[model samples]
Target: MRTEANRRKINRLYILGAGASYALTQGQTESLVAPLDIQFCQRIKDLQQRTRPKWVAAAARRVEKEYLHHVDFQITGLEELIRQQISDYEFIAAIHPRRTRGKRTKEEYLNDLNHLAAYLLSRARARDQSLLEKWLEKYLKGTEKRATRNRIITFNYDTLIDNVLLNWHSPQHVYFDNIWSSSTKSPTRLADRYPLLLKLHGSINWRCSEEEYAKLFNSAVTTDESKTTTYNTKDCHYIDKMWINNRVCTPEEQETPLIIPPLPQKPITSIAIFRYLWTYAYEYLYEARNIVIAGYSLPPEPPRVSRRLQLLREWSHEQVKQVFT
Candidate 1:
């Protein structure tokens, strides 16, 4: 149990990035579990030996041919490259025709791009589950008293945090923007708890119906269980298996993964859920007395995320006494 004085001093916030997960998964195997862009293409190729789909293999080849060889500048990762391509042709048709796009508009390619990226990320999460679970158990658990006061903001889309939290804390203790509450009781104030997690980039576990997506923009608190489902990354494999089997996908099966693609301009403004997440994050940042950034390099190109950090710095300039990286 935490004393009043200890609770008051627990205003620490942690910011996590891909490197945080990478560091945790290192040294256990010969192949890197969750790799950066430099190793992403090879990793996808390696995944091909297992159960990858034809479209995924084709996307891997495209990344190698168009991005790895042709591009002179330093590309961040495979997801960033795919996002750049999607943005470049945001309003125009592809220069070369695609067999898959025979009757579909160029805009439909965006879904294909996002699905490919999401698939790779999901596979990586599945591959590194053991090591990640160990790390979370050692660090995130056993410190429940401290956790209630500390806030976490993660840029990665993996559900590592969600998995650990669900096992360690009650559903009510962990708050996600999309997940419906299991109870109708009045919500407790977030400030009273220390280790609230905010996934700034979104999570793979999050799935919503079209109606819920529309409602997110109109309501302050969207909690309709019928319109949303939040399961672990492992559960999402059912949809992937449907794709692999080449079956007719249902609307529920085709629901979008809640990740915000790594675009130059993140879709925070256009997407209401993302906007709400940013607002929630700002509230935590405002009250943070110490900020510790782990494995997250403040990457420059993503304008919305970069801008959000800048705003946090300005908002908590006087309030934050210590910052550890």
Candidate 2:
């Protein structure tokens, strides 16, 4: 049987949503805050402009080449568009009639889906520095060593928190899911010693399937296990996991990074790593002394013609809150 001390090592858990990334630029000059779903349509329109951020222009070129007709890309509102497009492409492919006037082909629609994903990623990447660093400095009195009691689980795709916590040993010992194991290892010096920075909705810097990665970016595919762990179709690697200083595609001529895409139209249970990550989160939650949820809301949808006082609601009110150490 396990001792109580072993179970209590991880004392705090943080759950982050988009609002967390959005909060990063709360008081910066001309800093780009992470985009909420609604900002996408305008961002998409911005993609058409000749003068744009390097990352934006790079992703826009890809969209211009392979976008669907509706990538005529305008959603009067963003959240509704996110909900509509998040429906599985396979589902769209199955029901879409042949030669439909306005609809696109299966391949084309899939391309557009990825186009949106890439665009979202670029917006987050365009920021020069992470404001999260200062946020931490305000509370963290001094430099921390390798071991920490705090664990993080972020829903946003931005790497703000990743960049913040990734320096303990370069890739630092942060453990979320073992790319090598289907089962999560119990907390031990060899495997589970590091803080768990779980990216529940995947991350901006994670890449899966080397073959697919090469194919998407038109690179030469090689199975050189000498560099990376043996290629696994079932798992993903952080961009830095295999190579140093390489990013998944940047406008500054950075490498093309891969993401599992945000809250896809399909269930994430199909992905093995996601399964393990969520299980890890649940296990941590069960033993956590405190949980801090940084950013989430049920904010009102905007641009309504009526300027009347509307009730402000929250999705988590039906949930619970006890934020503290």
lDDT per model vs. reference: 0.52, 0.46
lDDT tens per residue, model 2, 1-325: 1233444344666777677777665444322556666666666656656454455555555544433335445542443444445443445556874534465443333334444555455346423354456654443213434445667766666666665555533332453423311112222234443345766656656544444333432333342332322223233322322222224444333233344443224234334444445545555565556677767653454523211111111112222244542
How far does residue 276 in candidate 2 sit from its true spot (Å)? 1.2
Best candidate per lDDT, number?
A: 1
Worst 10 residues of 1 by lDDT: 235-244
Q: Show model 1 residue runs off by greater than 4 Å.
A: 1-10, 30-32, 45-76, 90-107, 124-147, 181-195, 210-252, 300-305
lDDT of 1 by residue, 118-202 (tens): 6655544334677667755654565535454666788776555676777776433554422433212333434433335677876
- Cα deviation in Å at residue 233, candidate 1? 28
Candidate 2 TM-score, true structure as reference: 0.61
Clashes of 1: 7
RMSD per candidate (Å) reads 8.8, 9.5
